[model samples]
Target: MPDRILVPVDGSPLSKRALEVACDEYGTAEITALHVIDPTEPGYSIFGVEYDPSTAPRHGSEAWYERATELADELFEELDALADEHGVSIRTETVVGRPDREIISYATDEDVDQIIVGSHGRGEESRLLLGSVTEAVAFRAPVRVSLIR
Candidate 1:
């Protein structure tokens, strides 16, 4: 078992399942839950709410960043509760960038021993366009990676 594990979460069911796997299988390890805010898709909705340009904050604006932060916080809260239920503790982090790049960078920089991430994220169309973040991290990460479907 790894001494440290990294789990990238995006408020998606698959991501939540991945976190559960990490907690269940590697609960004794130090786990860090990472949420990447993709700037390229500023309109990405984490809450499954339809985007309404009429009322939504403008992309790249201060309001948008604040909203993103708020959403990240909400996600962390839910993830924390899940971890608690599993009798595990996790450190949570939020970073702004492409999910794949940021996740790999964080794992390498933080000396994470393993990475557990969802096979698919919330943005299927975007994944089709930009490639799978899970695949990218699995191929590029220096440590071992486990994908939860």
Candidate 2:
């Protein structure tokens, strides 16, 4: 009987599936959709590289931050629409940081009872070299983690 279920979404098909799983399994709980704004992401990167967002070109500029917020907003809107279609009320959240760290910290700070995540299978090589967010959260989160592939 999880009280609060946290789902970290990245607009991937896997993420959508994870949301659906949460809705189906935790129908009576508080389901939350969290979108992490990774400034180091290539698409939102101020510079050509995502190695370090703090040193990115104009990284702290108003335009750079605005772009990040814009991307987060778009994801939130899409999540909201999906939740509506599922006939479930979801609480939305946005945070700026590394996706895995942000998600883990939020779950702890907010006392989330469980976390439902998706596995995008970012390719076998990448998964071996660098684990995906779902893997990281599932391993590190203090709360229970349910992964939907």
TM-score, per-candidate, Cα-based:
0.89, 0.81
Per-residue lDDT of 20-53 in model 2, one digit per residue for the tens?
A: 8888878689999888877675456121223345
Clash total of candidate 1? 0
Against the true structure, candidate 2 reaches a TM-score of 0.81
**Residue 25 error, candidate 2, Å:** 1.5
Q: Which candidate leads in lDDT?
A: 1
lDDT of 2 at 141: 94
Compute the lDDT of residue 40 as modeled in candidate 1: 89
lDDT of 1 by residue, 1-149 (tens): 79999999878788899899999999999999998888888575364646677898998888888888888899899999999999999999999999899999999899999999877644655635223788899889999998786
The TM-score obtained by model 1 is 0.89
The candidate that wins on TM-score is: 1
Error of 1 at 62 (Å): 0.7
72 Cα displacement, candidate 2 (Å): 1.6
Candidate 2 has an lDDT of 0.78
The runs of at least 3 residues in candidate 1 whose Cα sits more than 4 Å from the true structure, single-residue gaps closed, are 44-47, 121-131
